[model samples]
Target: MSASTAVEKVNLREALLTRRRARTPAERESAAEAIALHAAALPALARATRVAAYLSLPSEPGTGPLLAWLAGRDVPVLVPVGRADRSMDWVEHTAGAVESGPLGVPEPSGRPLGPGALATCGIALVPALAVDHAGNRLGRGAGYYDRALADFPGVVCALVHDDELLPHVPHEPHDRPVDLVLTPAGVFRPSRDRDV
Candidate 1:
């Protein structure tokens, strides 16, 4: 990435984070519920054989509701455990069996299924600060998800607030674009003909 692009990304990330932090707890909860409803009804999700998802941070769109919904449907959910090399190991999501991992995100207490575990998943629900109509997602700049999903063949989806669905965001070649963006309002396909 160019120096100018890097600087722009830094500024944009901070602005988005500020907006997210300004939201009320109730607003966040309501959005989460709406997002869950929309995600649960996704056609791709209904056909998924396995799913990869993240445990959202307090500032990000909460995944707890959707996670619960998936569990209720008997969907096997794989959550990420960040590794030292910035890649992620997938583990089965087990409620109440989580502890903070290397990245300070909640991780499943079970043994990791390894990074290649994502190969078995049909879809991945990821956290994003903002995403453009083209599916370019703006994350926390850690490059964790970007690296993890670099070679993933499944449909990659990003979860964000309704307003975070933007017209554009700074991105680089290493920044993996999502196939779908799920916000509180609805789901958007960045590419109409994108193969699920």
Candidate 2:
């Protein structure tokens, strides 16, 4: 990443996070419901034998409803646990115990299935600050998801607000673009399909 591009990503992330924090609780709740509906109906998600997902922070679009919907169908869901080395581990979402990870992100308290466990899942629903029509996603700058999805073969999707689906987002060559984007409005493929 160029120095300018790195700065741009930082600024974009701050602005997006601020906007998210400004949302009313009711607005967030409604958006979450809509996003759940949009995502749960995806053919790829419907066919997944296993899923890799995240537990959204309060300010981000809620994934609780969608996770619940998946659980209802008996889909085995794995949520990420961030490690000190900035890598991620997958743990089954048992909906039992919960604890914060190294990054302060909520993680399933179950035994980790290791990073390679992600390969077993058919699709991954990842978090993003914003994404472009080309599928370039602006994450929170931790490089956790970027590294995790770098060589991932399955479908990788991002969940963002309707407005966060931008016409473009500054991206680096190493940035892993998403194959699909899920928003409150609907689920969308990038302007062009990206090879998995």
Candidate 3:
């Protein structure tokens, strides 16, 4: 990225993180429920027996209710295990499987299914600070999700706050665009001129 774009991304990340930190506990919980409700209604989730998703950090949209809802429906979910190299490993989500892991990210303790297993997922629910109308995602400055999903074919959705769905975000060639963005309001498909 050029110097101007790099500076813009840093400032945007800071602003978004600050907004996340300011959310009250009750507001966070309510938002999580709303997000899960909207996401669960998707035909993709309804048709899938398995999905790839993440257990959220406290500062982001709480995914606990969604995970539990998936489990209840007998839809097994695979969560990302942060690796030393910043690549992701997949772990099957079982009851009470998540624990605090590297970089304070919530992780599953089940047997790893490895990165290649992502191809089997009907849809992927990823985490992001913000996403643009053009489908550019602003992750937490780590390329783990982008690298892990380099060639994934299924629909990829980033869970973000309603206000986090911005008009634009600085992106590079290495960035992997998402097919959809889920927020407390509903599911939104970024308006890309061409299909990803």
Per-candidate clash tally: 0, 0, 0
Show the lowest summed lDDT stretch of 10 residues, model 2: 187-196
Candidate order by lDDT, highest to lowest?
2, 1, 3
Candidate lDDT values, in order: 0.91, 0.91, 0.90
Model 3 accuracy (lDDT, Cα): 0.90
| Candidate 2 TM-score versus the reference | 0.97
Across 1-196, the per-residue lDDT of candidate 3 in tens digits comes to 7889889889999999999999999999999999999988888778887899998988999888898899889888999998999999898888676789968888999899888989889889999999999899999888999999899988888999999999999989999999988899998888875342
TM agreement with the true structure for every prediction: 0.97, 0.97, 0.95
**Candidate 3 minimal-lDDT segment of 10 residues:** 187-196
Q: What is the lDDT of residue 94 in candidate 1?
A: 89
User: In model 2, where do residues sit more than 4 Å from their true spots?
Assistant: 194-196
Model 2 pairs whose backbones collide: none
Compute the lDDT of residue 110 as modeled in candidate 2. 88
Q: Write the per-residue lDDT of candidate 1 for residues 1-196, one digit (tens) a residue.
A: 8999999999999899999999999999999999999998898899997999988888889999999999999999999988888888899998888898866888888989999999899999999989998889999899989998999999999999988998999999899999999998998888546865
The alpha-carbon deviation from the true structure for residue 59 of candidate 2, after best TM-score superposition, in angstroms, is 0.7
